[model samples]
Target: MSADNRIIRVIKGRRPKVVVIGGGTGLPVIVKSLHEQNADVTAIVTVADDGGSSGIIRDYINVVPPGDIRNVLAALSDLPSLYLDIFQYRFNSKDAFFAGHAIGNLIIAALSEMKGGIFDAVQQLSQMLKVDGHVYPASNTPLTLNAEFTDGTTLSGEAEITGAGKHIQRVFVTESDLNAKEPPQAVNQVIDAIMNADVVVLGPGSLFTSILPNLMISNLGDAVKATKAEIIYIVNIMTQKGETEHFTDADHVRVLNRHLGEDFVDTVLVNIAPVPSDYLDHQKYDEYLVPVEHDYQGLRDLGCRVISADFLQLRNHGVFHDGDKVATEILNLAFQVGTMKKRRY
Candidate 1:
């Protein structure tokens, strides 16, 4: 080979770019792992959450969901525990004020109100935390998540939607055709990151609420489909009681295809390792871990590569997806596909 050709190849073999979309702990695990792989990462988080501490702040102070955003930021935190712990600290007081709110959530709320925009507040927080990657709201619009059942029952709000006692036949926002304004300018940065990315990750969270909600956005989905990047959907290890109910791996993919298209997700990550029966949380969660969906064969048949890994984790309060293990699988996938321009070792 020529000397100039070798220099060009060495220069081009730099770190990869990654974009992650979704809420909950799942996407954070992937982000933490990918961050270590020396990839340029962007996390486009969902703003539709309207429950728990996030809901309280959203209602009283009027801001995008901060709980999920905080979780993601913690996962991306590279510095010592001092800063991260302070941000995550919760005031446990008998007083009516600051009872259950995390200091991080309130900090975001205060900045958001002070700055007059949720996206701007998140950027400021990101800088304060010195988070490893860029994080942005999927959309700046304050949205109410709507769920419609097969029987035609309609539910509004994330809390009520989870308790409908019926399978979510379809999920959409109240103003589906709102001509919803473009996603926050920060999101376009995520898209631009994707344009330069080798691969993008979709989920390992709630299939409908966490993953699909972002894609349902008019412009976000368009950017994803148009990007020259490979997209992967990290399937969940267990199905939620009222949410997925009895969803299989194939059912999850079908739901994705329904939203984006048949070829929307390039690869589907599955858990092939045997989960210990003792890991099941029937007593607390009141539901069994739904078996891995039988759609692995079908996914491979349909032209999507199905990569299996040990993606399960046992935690006391949390559900599934061990952060480090899930991150390892993601790095494995990225390296296997040459999507991440980094050495695995």
Candidate 2:
């Protein structure tokens, strides 16, 4: 097809979508950038967190923790204004009922209760945020992540599993054998996004804990593989000490393949720049911020195209990506390069 014809085709009939699969703070970072870049982003967030606010919500109120979902919402909230600001606020009074609670989390939990389902709750909030894209819990049911340790002991929840300090032999959900009702909005939206998407991006976040948890759900792994969209795996800039201690770029992929299988990913976006060794002094081996000694060639040999760049965010008031810079790269990947996936062009 001619360039004009291709562009016309893309504009006329194309979805030019992006389906991001993961959870934790990083997924929203990707979502924020891509939403700005104008990819019809559909975030399939992991619902397996059994920690902190989310864990409390799940155990006490029998609802999915709104923390990560709230993060995704805030990230995609239309920039510089009321929606984002109101949702991102945390209560201050220690004696207050809302103390230590995020307004977003409260909103989502309330919506879930009124709407009578997690999916509807998210929809209600998304409409309010005017978020640039869609967000869904990977599963509708509040899920418990079950991890089997190398020592043959099984941890019952995500927080417990991660906190147990054991080498995870394999991780799976409690009702793995049960057929889950896919959050209708989530399942259909993700499938539809995939069929029309120009790119599907995964990770730069926690490996087993965050990313794979989503890929394991809603039959999402199968849907992703079935899509015609180019797939890109963005590698994390630093190693997460306890979860990814002494890991390299290749180790990340290795873990992905181990759970989801070897052919699960196509391309990996890696940071090629050298960080000052002084940065390493802060990255203790005790807390999951060890060095990410990347093996680019190994990933390439594994059939993943390693797209290199200076993909790091400088230190700031908050410890995360500079949104504008990351958004620039996201725009390039989605609109400029189309994709770096080897099979696409």
Clashes of each: 1, 4
lDDT of 2: 0.69
TM-score of each: 0.87, 0.85
Location of the lowest summed lDDT over 10 successive residues in candidate 1: 2-11
Q: Tell me the whole-model lDDT of each prediction, alpha carbons only.
A: 0.72, 0.69
Tens digits of per-residue lDDT, candidate 1, 112-213, equal 888887788888888887777788877765666888888889987877877767888878754322575643232466567666666778887887788877
Write one digit per residue (lDDT tens) for candidate 2, span 139-191: 76677677778889987776676678777766775442246554322356656
Best by lDDT: 1
**What's the true lDDT of residue 167 in model 1?**
84
With a 3 Å backbone cut-off (N, CA, C), the pairs that clash in candidate 2 are: 240-288, 241-288, 241-289, 242-288
Candidate 2, which ten residues in sequence have the lowest lDDT sum?
A: 1-10
Model 2 ranges with Cα > 4 A deviation? 1-15, 175-186, 279-286, 317-345
Q: Determine the C-alpha RMSD for candidate 1 after optimal superposition of all C-alphas.
A: 6.2
